[model samples]
Target chain A: DAGITQSPRHKVTETGTPVTLRCHQTENHRYMYWYRQDPGHGLRLIHYSYGVKDTDKGEVSDGYSVSRSKTEDFLLTLESATSSQTSVYFCATYRDPANTGELFFGEGSRLTVL
Target chain B: GESVGLHLPTLSVQEGDNSIINCAYSNSASDYFIWYKQESGKGPQFIIDIRSNMDKRQGQRVTVLLNKTVKHLSLQIAATQPGDSAVYFCAEIPSSGNTGKLIFGQGTTLQVKP
Candidate 1:
């Protein structure tokens, strides 16, 4: 868990609704990432932030947008939720600079769009 | 589209026996690989990681092996216990523009029979 917390652990909303998931970390990490998990797809990177206000898109970033106004918090927002966007979202922070892939993930937020 | 995949969707093993989970990646350029364990109602946790420079890496009771020529990776757990029962995923950091964007395999569910 590494002091990482995600708000709205579970949410059920209708399609076309707006949904926002929040990830907060207690430590000052240089890297933070958002990933989504589906049935057939293990986990796909949605977005990531290297530094405060510096963010980049990932493998499945088409329907999502992210913001990192502060180093401890990264937010993912779906302007208009779709059924396809219903999945479990995870937020991770880098463990070591040398091994960038090593991450400490949060509990995850489950969103269901009907 | 180069993707990571698992040979078996599920693996059943007896307690105290060793278990091996295999993964394959279509992208040979991927250099960094990692394994994650996810239990029910929890986020994925980092297990181990290996760089392309080395073929094998070991942790407390887990080992990760990478075969670059065949674009394959495997995780071996010794003395499998009930706590070790979870879904394991293999992820790779593609040697591309953004290495932080890790691509994950579908995952293998390890069921330890008591």
Candidate 2:
């Protein structure tokens, strides 16, 4: 039931440290995205990639960066983790032109910065 | 100013009842809309979707109603169950073909009580 898998399902790290979350997909989708969910706020897009090595910033990409070196893998990195950055992260993939961009999401990665 | 938003923050319904969730989008250029369900500690799952050309779409136990006239979208669930309790979100994709980006609504937390 898991076409996509997020590594380190749950992680806790100290503030100011660097953290990276990985999203891997078995489906060979063309578009991949990373989003973070927090209370009272909608899922904010962090970054997305249209193809290999093609990445773009989203609405809330100030402190985060992303890379899609391959078609099956997308990585999100926090340069300096902050407590305010703690939230549940999700990875999603979509087949655009065909399904009209119906996004299929992975389970999730819960990160806690202290 | 094409933002997707929900009308309510929370909705509580009795078991075996029908539940309705409403959303409003600001961009008429958006051609695709989708609904997602998220549990407490998990990622969001695709529920249903509707295209701009169509007004209604139905799935097994869920239906999506799109009103392009008013830029409103709604999700209807038949016989709401406890298992259906989760946060629901509505997302819209602009017709600009930026398949990598989706504007997500705030969210509505559904509570089904027996």
What's the DockQ of model 1? 0.71
Native-referenced Cα lDDT, model 1: 0.90
lDDT of each residue in B1-114, candidate 1, tens digit only? 779999999999999999999999998877688899999989988899888888999999999999989988999999999999999999888887444667889999999999
TM-score of the second chain in each model?
Answer: 0.95, 0.97
Please identify model 2 stretches exceeding 4 Å from their true place: B98-100
Question: lDDT for model 2, on a 0 to 1 scale?
Answer: 0.90
Task: Give candidate 2's TM-score.
Answer: 0.95
* lDDT on C-alpha atoms for all candidate structures: 0.90, 0.90
Error (Å) of candidate 2 at residue A46 is: 0.7
Candidate 1 lDDT over residue span A25-106, tens digit each: 9877778999999998899899999898999998789989999999999999999999999999999887445554778889
Score every model by TM-score: 0.95, 0.95
Instruction: Candidate 1: give the clashing pairs.
Output: none
